[model samples]
Target: MKKITPANLVPLLTAALPEKDMAHILNALVQFLRDGGVKRASQRFDLLLDAFKQNPELAREFGTRFHRWLGSIHIYPALVGLGIFSRSGFAREMGIRIYERFMPSFKDLNNLRDVFLYLFQRQNDEKWLHTVSLLQWLSLYDTLCRHSDPAAVQTASRHLEQARLHALEMLSIWVAAEELEPEFTRLEPKLMEVDSAFVALHQEISRLVAHYRSGQTEHYDTAHIAVMMEQCRAQVERLRRKGTGAGAGSSVKVAHLLERLSQTLDRLAVLLDIQTAPDEKECRRHCVRLLNSLTTAAVEQHSTELLRRRSINMLAKSISENTSGHGEHYITRNKREYFAMLASAAGGGVIIALMAGNKIRITGLGLGDFTTAFLAGLNYGIGFMFIHIVGCTVATKQPAMTAARIAEHVEHKAGARALESKLAKLLIDVARSQAVAVFGNVVVAVIVASVVAAAVAAHTGAPMLDAHTAAYQFKSLQPFTQPTLWYAAIAGVWLFCSGIISGFYDNRADYLNLRKRLTVQPLLKRLLPARPRAFLADYLHRHYGSLAGNFIFGMLLGMTGWFGHLLGLPLDIRHVAFSSANLGYAAVSDHSGFLYFLLNLAFVLMIGAVNLVVSFSLALTVALRSRGARIESLSKLIDTLWLQIKANPLSLLFPVQPPAAAGGNGNGGNGSSANGKAKE
Candidate 1:
């Protein structure tokens, strides 16, 4: 029994082909190229190419059969639209993905689009195609087309030429429309032109393609084609910048469209470059790139991974940018700003303490889980909203907000040294800001809750909490006895989600022009004079997202316990401020001894640590990815941070006295001036 390996298998297949049906053998070879792992496919392809070099007769027989097979199938759709703008809107594309998951489109073997879809439909299929080198890809393609009398091969070239022209025209229109978008126009009115570079570039490329179709041999002037393309590209970048800014109000749909337009321009530019190649060698290299793009594009379009990822990144970046306006205030760059954050967090803590007591009252009412959740949630929501209205900070919510500022800075090109310095400093500010906020919230909340409990007990001759409720609250906060850390992590996730909600609403505020709508609002008109109405509208415009996010976050926190009970799960949130406040009430009401209270206090701090760590890690991960920061840079950042930490550990808990301003007093005067400097 001979063990068949790639070493012997190819020769054996070649010998047996003489006695076998050529059509079946050819189909098997084609299938070999399409399927299997990269190494196996490469081995088989190399073997076939070697066999062809040795025998001309066999090569012709195989080549003719292959192209004849190719000539019979449709290739236009695959060439022109496979990974291009075949799908437009973000919602439509997502719907298509959802539909395909349940009920896929039927594949027609004769159509190249369907055939490509059929061959590489899996999410992981794009990996192998990307790893295949341009030289190997070129070798495989040239071999297939080598012995062709095939009209299909010629038709493919013609289709590519046609696609190039069409892409040029389509890109021009897309660019024109995007530049004319009100926001884009307003952002850069001076960049506009009469013979718009986009339209002119389209005309130039179309002319070049016409020359090739007619077989003209004269030198083509495409020097300015590159210049024109650059102009269009520059404009695209401007729109991207303006679109992602605060109040620019970009959507996933608009972001996706911007990405697709950029891609179309790139592919079109390559096509133009290929035609203007100086020699056969240059032309072949250009052709190799296109050949590689064709198959990779098919695989990508079928997988749809690239489009989905890029669209989401663009949207996430926009969301981060939108919310980052408030994030700057969350970061404290100096001593004055740091103290202000502590004060704000302390204010928030006082309200949270009262809210915790109300939650205790609500829970003791013996209501249904859903009804309990509703009332408790209402209490939480209105309380948090009141805190926001009065200008206070919640430590848990800072991660999502502060992450956007860090992300925006990562995108800046300030040279490697400056970036490292500024980034590390910014990180220090964020860390200290977080520390002070948590310290203020926890300590103040605990103190307030304890004092209130003592006051009630003194007046009413009994503690506010009954024995059972006090015991239950203590049990819930125990880290070792329960999955309390896991619960805290859940609370962190909710905090992150609330931040995203805040950003989305902030973007929507600008997108919907809420202030103008409110100015014309009928209710406002009836309630107040124009001067006062305008002021109220302006205030709501600024705080709309914060108000909505805080309210919804409260609801989520309130509902988790109910949902857990309904599903027979141990799911519940353990936010740090709330847990600390609960501890204060439980200790005072239960009349627990000092030793036992200290033990519970240790657990409360541990819970707070978990809550902050989980929320901050998630927020940072999303923010960095959305900004497309390189892994290399992130590694560098990690190294830089370690150096920074070793040099001055206190910097993470106290202000750095930024080196550039070291000679100066570095007091930062007051909170407002310090805040002005922290803005990116």
Candidate 2:
């Protein structure tokens, strides 16, 4: 095979490349590269790159599709491993290029939202949290540049307020939780001491905002901000010591205090100018101060506080914790079964509802005005039962398994290095499962809508027999007919929307929380017992899994309208199906018995199916993607182990030995002998 170059593969990728083919190509490229067919490998690689460069739309579509496929397979771990082997400078360079390509368009709010989301996903796999942090800072800085515009400033002000509110809420939650802990009994006073400091930080931010609003440049002085920050750090330090002490409640109090302090610091950092180099420096200085404060307050100072200690120790414990007993059992027995059962029950309910509603309509029932109402009731009841069963099942099962897997994976001796590789793959599997679930729901919704619509059209002439005219007559029922349809349609649409929103948000949030746990002091301590530096280096790799989830979820959401249309359902049924007939006119025109029941039945099915398919598909895709990522990540991790071993045989024993020296001479023996002995 000829060496594929960026230029050569562009046409193929641009021409709606199939996913299977894409994967095959990638596999081939990998093999070719391994076999020293660099020219062929490069040709293919260049084809992809050229395609991306020449056609923005194609680039976007290809990127999105590729990302989706990767997400579905939970292939982030392999990518992460690739990234790790590729070298930091190269990764950083690619990251920078990505940023440049997308940053220009981010001036628009929607674009900004997209960019933020994109950056968020990038944060998952790329060793670039600091880079992302920088980008976010810059984005905000750009927004601030338009400070001269009242509307812009107002927007910024709004965002700033929201950030503050979030910080406050987090602080409150942390504080309340801490106060309940036994260790906080003695540390209460020390915790209180920092309250004033927090108050001051809040006040300073408020003052800075006011100063900026009033047109006083000096009011945003970095020096004064630095001083307040220093004080906040000192107070935080004191609180840390208090909580870390021997008092039974100290640990709890300290954890709460540190959490609050961290939030406050984050808020403060956001409020400051961070555009220029100097501004960035100031921001970093303050950030470091806050980090130091958190470290001192929560970790170093509270070393003895069991709660505080536990906070730090939990990661390690989680990693090392045995899964052979309850953990494993919970995952396999309780978790999987629960989700599976829920899915089955939910699916069954929808099927039953459709069948029942059809049967009722088909049977020429004599129940006059009550028929439509009865059908609606039946539909809702069935829908609720299905949703409840599935929801409960998912709730009971997946989380425990997820936690257990994470614990087991991170605890293995080689877990830290392997974690990055595995995390992405796991995430991808979860994402794919979630996508499948979403797709399934979409299919169900479409099917139900089509079925109901067909049924309604067919049953336009059923008999209306029983009931007092005053209570159950056509006029009285007329008002409800359209509204009920509207309600169902609206509910369906809402479900679809909710699925998209929740899936993306939850996936991203999970990744961020995981990243935070992995990077944060106590958690980091537990997860990276052998090599903290290696853990940090690989952190970005793990993050990619989450990014993959977000991208996939978003893509799925984008396709909802198209999918709905494909499924033979109207995206908006309000105008066509539920537009209220002239109120006074509808009463006189549509009093016929059979027509109304059919309409009601149709609406019911449409609503039920829409809700079912959308919700289920969203859930399933997420799960699949996450699982796939985990599996792939584990595989790549083995490869990473081998690579590390090959690169430096002696360093295998001393995993903690610095990479710089280990990679340089190949025989440096500082800590290598001890490490080798330990391994032996």
CA lDDT, every prediction? 0.74, 0.36
Q: Top lDDT: which candidate number?
A: 1
After superposition, candidate 1 runs with Cα above 4 Å error: 1-27, 34-36, 61-76, 97-125, 140-195, 209-215, 413-415, 418-422, 525-529, 593-596, 630-653, 656-661, 664-680
Superposed on all Cα atoms, the candidates' RMSDs to the truth, in angstroms, are 4.4, 26.6
For model 2, the run of ten residues with the poorest summed lDDT: 671-680
* lDDT digits (tens) for residues 475-523 of candidate 2: 3223254343443344334433333332233333332344444555575
**TM-score, per-candidate, Cα-based:** 0.85, 0.25
Which portions of model 2 miss their true places by more than 4 Å? 1-195, 215-219, 248-257, 270-680
Could you tell me which residue pairs clash in candidate 1? Answer: none
Model 1 scores a C-alpha lDDT of 0.74
| Model 1 agreement with the true structure over 496-562: per-residue lDDT tens digits | 8888888888877876678888989998899899999899888777788888889999999999988
Q: For model 1, what is the alpha-carbon lDDT of residue 632?
A: 44
